[model samples]
Target: MSRTIPRTALLAALSLVTAAGATATVFGTSAGAATAGCKVEYQITNQWNNGFGANVIVTNTGDPVASWNVEWSYANGQQVTQGWNAAITQSGAAVSAKSLSYNGSLATGGSTSFGFNGSHDGTNAVPATFKLNGVTCNGATDPTTPPTTPPTTPPTTPPPTGGRADNPYAGAKVYVNPEWSAKAAAEPGGTRVSNQPTGVWLDRTAAIAGVNGGMGLRAHLDAALAQKGSGELVVQLVIYNLPGRDCSALASNGELGPTDIDKYKTQYIDPIAAILADPKYAGLRIVNTVELDSLPNLVTNVSGRPTATPNCDVMKANGNYVKGVGYALNKLGSIANVYNYLDAGHHGWLGWDDNFGASAEILKQAATAEGSTVANVQGFIVNTANFSALKEDHFSIDDSVGGTSVRQSKWVDWNRYTDELSYAQAMRTKLASLGFDSHIGMLIDTSRNGWGGAARPTAAGPLTTVDTYVNGGRYDRRIHLGNWCNQAGAGLGERPQAAPAAGIDAYVWMKPPGESDGASKEIPNNEGKGFDRMCDPTYTGNVRNGNSMSGALPNSPLAGQWFSAQFQELMKNAYPAL
Candidate 1:
């Protein structure tokens, strides 16, 4: 009654078919003839870029030489765009493949192999109903043909059409950083150096006040309210400064000491609790307390630079800090969305297996110490300061090293950064296989990877293709856009028209725009110099120029501008209904 094929026959069928198609079978074995047995073996390998490669092995156990056919079905909105190795002929959701060239006469213990490449957005599964030489196989008395039905499409909702009714966050209130602002300033002519530090710091009160008092905050709330009908667009406040103000700061260079922990609780942790306690922003969803580490040494530093260790002790203490913070946030008893994520190094940096395992262990320990379980700790953020293969290679961790060793073989190459589609797809597959499928997500720094910063020197036409891949494709779901270094450049405008591919989610500006990296010590108008100038607009010249002239600094304001622009664009593309 059950329809099943033998494993050996399946492999032989697939192998013979693959060989006939000019594609090699990476892993598989042949079984006996298909007449006597009913076992099946198949694998989906090299899933990347909305496409995947598959290998199916089948065995025949009954009689002598005879022709055969294999059938299968796919779920989860999966569709076969193109295939190789075996001859694939599809009718709606039902796909059938056959061996054109048989491997001589099959004995009772013969086997065959077949495989092909496919494209899909959801789950992958094997189909039922197979036949050999017109004889219904798998011992099924009745082999009913699958029905032909067109794939279903997602629903479309219109944008906001009314008043406070249109406002997504009608009663919801949010706190903002008063210091936030964005703008570029003139620079003196010289060899410019980037002033953007490698880390982020936040003044809790200032951030909360800015959000509570500004029109920008209202705009964010409005946008969220608009999208509320679709799904919860929980407003998040990222407090990155912990232990140090910035990555390059002297204090940050030191390991996280007890003093750092104590100060963090008083200055940062307590204020967060106070904000959550307030009734106005009671419905707030604090998605994550992201610790943005800009320095390369944040993880494992081969350069021997000083790094902050977020070990078990620090994390445990921080857990108590968060628990206390959570208690305060729950004052309204309506704040149920607060969560935390430790910034894990980028894919290239974490490598694979051992390196990733070690970092994961540290995270697990920290989460446990925090008095929270791994479930409470959201996935790690994979980001980098410099968006290039050269910079990403500094921390490349792959699966090349044996499973028992710290290293494993390299699953991805940093050189693919320019290949946005390939890069995003590869990461999706790699992450899923590593158990981060559901929890892990990526935040891409759209600022520099496209045509800004160091990429300027290597610019080769617009990164429009890459943008489309990240924002207009199915693979963009796990990706969140961040303008890491936003002095100026291309890729800064609105989101494209087409909704991101099936799996792609919303886009947001992780990095606030306009903030300066620092002042130009060498060249004028460089990112470092731009950041410095923006921070203190009037302060001209370079670091050589003493910190004089005072107005609001650039970091906060510039960030606001970028954030506003990105949000608007997101509404345009993904949330037109909002």
Candidate 2:
């Protein structure tokens, strides 16, 4: 499993040192060119306990720069935990940010910006120096705003990676994916453009946070280690934000274009694998949910669902989705100490004939996509962030009891599986036949499916509606079973636990409950980004025969921001009761 990646592949990946421990700044050798036309501004946009976010805009006050690099230092012992947009790295107290290929060129008097989420001690002081292309800005001063410290809990030191092999995960500790929770924690709640007050519910959003593709993983790893004190650490990384991301969905659309598979490989996957291969993190157990919703959509509804797979037709037009995810599995699947769980759509989805075995077979193709065998794979993840029950206490995959027509029948779908557990076992069997290891396990997301209490039956009736009958015990009664916004009446599912069933390895909270699924279709956001129709209360796309309607879940913040009202609702309706 530890075979060397080709030299051509390792060339760039091996040199991507995106993070370094620095308490003090170490100046690097500068090219002696005079940089008179460059100017930069750093502003702290939002702050929370022990952390803050900053946006930096670079202006070419003079001539156009074919390329650019910005460097700064954090005084007062503040560490740049993680960042996005620009490729950021820290050495000692010094930090350097280079523009991505997309942001490298700036016309004269033009401006481009990048943002980052970072942490600081109680005393936050802006850097006194700024340099673009290694030349210092002339009239820059330290920011005057006082530093703030949000409420924080000290992290327990993470125990050795994976713990004892025989007792892997015996520490009973679930690692939070800080990659996301940290972002949600920073969202402002009041009625503001970036404010999403309900984000408080995601205080522990990531027992392990996912770091998306191409944003660089080194900084995230550094942040995770810093956040983990002296306890067992289980880190969850969601390898998402793919080019042509959310193929059909627009609300959670990603930055990379679908055609950029080359970038996805060299820039995204390679660098990600490099960071995870670090010797320092060898003792940390990492759970990698590879490309959430990427492959599954292509298998189930790429051409059919309008509300769910909005841009899928364009994606299918080009072959980026296939090449992109395949390369990801080939590279990341075989890493050491990394548990790669490929995302499989929830039960209701694969439960349909058009999906099941086809999805399983797709998983097989992806496992061996890049010259690697299925042995490169770990296992499969079912119901990732989707509101599907672990098991419908009322129905079975083979249950043929009720409903008028086959379309309205809950237990008459492909091979008759209605719950996540049965689907998972069946998938494991299918996967084994595809050459996966016998020990291959499945992860069921218990995040939002906890409709156990009153909402269990969720008014999903009228008997004629096959969806309602099949999903009778489900808390999610959205227009289409594919509705994935911040669902209404959703309660916390089973607490994070390992081995809940025969083929199921763990019940993880893959989706932080309070985070928004898409912007409220009501509010307007920035360009190249749009509100998910599913979040619109008035959305009517996923409905069938006026019976099922998509968008049952209301307006939400951007994909991962906190939703206050949703949090309250989740708490009010927690299943096992937190």
Candidate 3:
């Protein structure tokens, strides 16, 4: 939605390890202002045939800095491939990792970590030295201590029976829905990513049983048992049938009316919670993505906000959204094997000053409502079914073009954070401050947000104008930040993985890549879905999208239905291209 008011910038404060290409750039390495001293710890976490993952933690031992960068050289012919939490670039044996907008500050003795996946032919030795802001650190790999070999596959302690693991996704295989897999494989080149794990959306009461002969919750969990095969497996269930769901967008409105809180609790959540609590499925780690786009609507779309909507005002007044989400969390979270992750709107929807803190407080209110507490929530998920980029390499909120801040750019529109990773991590910190568990993890739905086709920018845009600086270099190619339909030039992002960053639990494909966001034009259907102009490419604009073109793909099918054209486009533009 359009957030027109010019507000003060709020910088991010957390760490997230993300993927990036290997290119050489010199920004905050040798050119950076000097720091007193530092210490670096580099360790190989996992290894494979020809590739491995490394975690680097840097401690600033000197004066405090608003931002910092670390530099090092590889002894072997190692190549840095993908990284997160920091903007990394590599050339020959030398590499530089610069802090992002969130994790830049190092308050003398403060430490932050980022990780990357790299490749090596035979030897993958640790870097002997590291420099922070141009000053050499005390050590890289400790000289006194010998480096221990790491295991090839990530180790796993099988999830304890009838208990929650620190991270359910860790050392676990995510369940793949055969139904979606078959649909994807039926496409021309969909077989490439067809087997990827995506959430099984239970959007209505009929879906809880079986919608039109489709697999129900029990069937999926039973299939997960087959997939378990002695190892842990995560079954992702999207608990999405909230009353007046997605009030800000008509495309994904629910079957229940605004006041049907009781129907949502009994017919929808109770049945699903019963099935999950069954001992037969207790071995499987059940992850419920509870209520997508539900709570944030109460904060951003309610009365008195710039982007207020009548539908949202009604939902807020009735308090059903909060009551429904709270009841769902309490019921589902009570099961030891089930982990409930509430949906936190993406950065584009809630990264502004007015929306950010207020949204977190609203979440706290919901968590405590209906006899639920913060402990019921395992974590929070962000960027679900939206096209916010995971990270923006070219421009930061702190960057200025001709003395004009990038936050002032048309696309950024005074938003504090640039991308989803920073927003999720910062949001986690904010949630913990509001009495939620400090260790609660964050999940970023990476499906269809890659923006990594030929149009993907390689380096920083020219400094001629703030707009050019952000628009040219941004990985998200949508015309406006609020465009959330089947967007043009969108791509599949990083495949699902666990513990990829500091506070993140995983990068999940919770939103199946093949399903349409909404129909491009009005089409009647038995499903409760309604056509929203944001999905129509021909629609010129809305206040939510800065009154700009919708930037949607044409000829799209109804939401949750297969749009083969959009599926093919996602695969064609997928990052880490197939």
Candidate 4:
């Protein structure tokens, strides 16, 4: 065999020797083939979390490889909280990271994987540069940088603070009584009419029987909840009853005498306490006893006569009847949410000073007698009737009837209806001057405002008017507006026509949708005498008398339907996305 050795075999042997020598020079190993198999590559993937996690792909770039070690660094404020799948060690900001228990050797040109968690910020974060077995990896990218934080701005003028403002009427809520007579009749054990000298009739039983056992009460509550919606609206429930009782000092007809007062306490007031105590209606706040007392001692009309004797002196001397109401209010306060206000006639009816200051004094005395805190007394409610004329009433500015004359009058001018915007602003300014801007708020009856086809005022108009007068340096921001008497005819249909401005907090149904404003006898059909006649697409008659076309009976489904529709419309127009 030595004498005849093949040339091909000799060449193969020589080639093997040269490859071995080259491997020895590169790896310093006699096992050159084995050393050449150690080449590797690294890759990072899936970095995420509050910090970051990554899967590292390692491949044998030259030959088959066993285990490997990787290294990288992190910037300041960026610390790795936790990591997985790979062994990791951190020394300050630097990481001596490596794959742990990486099973099986990687084949040449084949890839293996590992993972880790890291921290980063928009500022100094950099993708970790990776290496395998003390050697840098090919095709390995650096860690990604994080995003930067934006800057914040401060407000120029701070919000008004301290009990809201000087205006106590601002943002005040108002509720209207729908069934005055019915509620009076429902007093428990019936109300007694001493008939003074004549033996007292057992009127208590019948009166108590008349109380609808919470039906009407619940309806009113429901009506309030429906309009108020959680805490969005400041809710006021005015309990108006005809023939309301008076402490011996202010008895009218024979009704609500001393005996009747006792019975009313046990029946009407007591039941109210029970209902309020129930958790189902815990949100009912502001229960005001709106007494239409036998007209103030000065007035003498068919409905104004005192059936008994004039007790103006007694009323003046001791505010007894007022106290009685306070007493009842105290009881209701124990079980229910309430804020009582004595009814103060409208500006047109009651001299401004008398209605505002004098009435406040009377309420103060009554509240004192009842042991109620000054806050409990609250303030007064100013209301207008159907017979009230725009020229005579300041609230007439909200009327919608069209005409050149209607546009000019200072009180009820159509253009001036736009003036309510100014009025609200002026009132806020006035309240602030009085130091009541923070505590008081005003409530406007918009029920009749939309009467005679007036469109509901846009929020921008009112806000602009208010801002022009108040925050614009011309007026104060204390006077807030509460839109009451919201009926279907109140331009709810044109709700989306304009954006609602601020200052007007709530639009409540002060006059429930269905109640009638008495028969049409007082007003003619042309004046929109009948209830449900105002907004009817077909009703083309002129407003007769001055009857509101919006007042309908409370129990009617049509009224409820209209109310539901108007509410939806108001929400759409006033608070679309909120």
lDDT of every predicted structure (CA atoms): 0.35, 0.59, 0.80, 0.34
| Per-candidate TM-score against the hidden true structure | 0.38, 0.62, 0.73, 0.36
68-90, model 4: which lDDT tens digit per residue? Answer: 56565655455654444346788
Top candidate (TM-score) = 3
Q: Indicate the TM-score of model 2.
A: 0.62
Global Cα RMSD, each model: 25.1, 14.7, 19.9, 28.0
Tens-place lDDT digits, model 3, residues 141-167: 112211221101245635444467878
Worst 10 residues of 4 by lDDT: 192-201
lDDT score at residue 508, model 3, on the 0-100 scale: 93
The order by descending TM-score is 3, 2, 1, 4
Once fitted onto the true fold, the runs of candidate 3 whose alpha carbons sit more than 4 angstroms away are 1-153, 157-162
Model 2 agreement with the true structure over 27-113: per-residue lDDT tens digits: 222245443556665655444567766656677665578888888887778777667667888888899988777568878666666
Better of 1 and 4 by lDDT: 1
Off by over 4 Å in 1: 1-206, 209-232, 245-258, 277-286, 294-298, 302-335, 339-342, 347-357, 384-440, 452-505, 521-578
Worst 10 residues of 3 by lDDT: 7-16
Whole-model lDDT for model 2 versus the true structure?
0.59
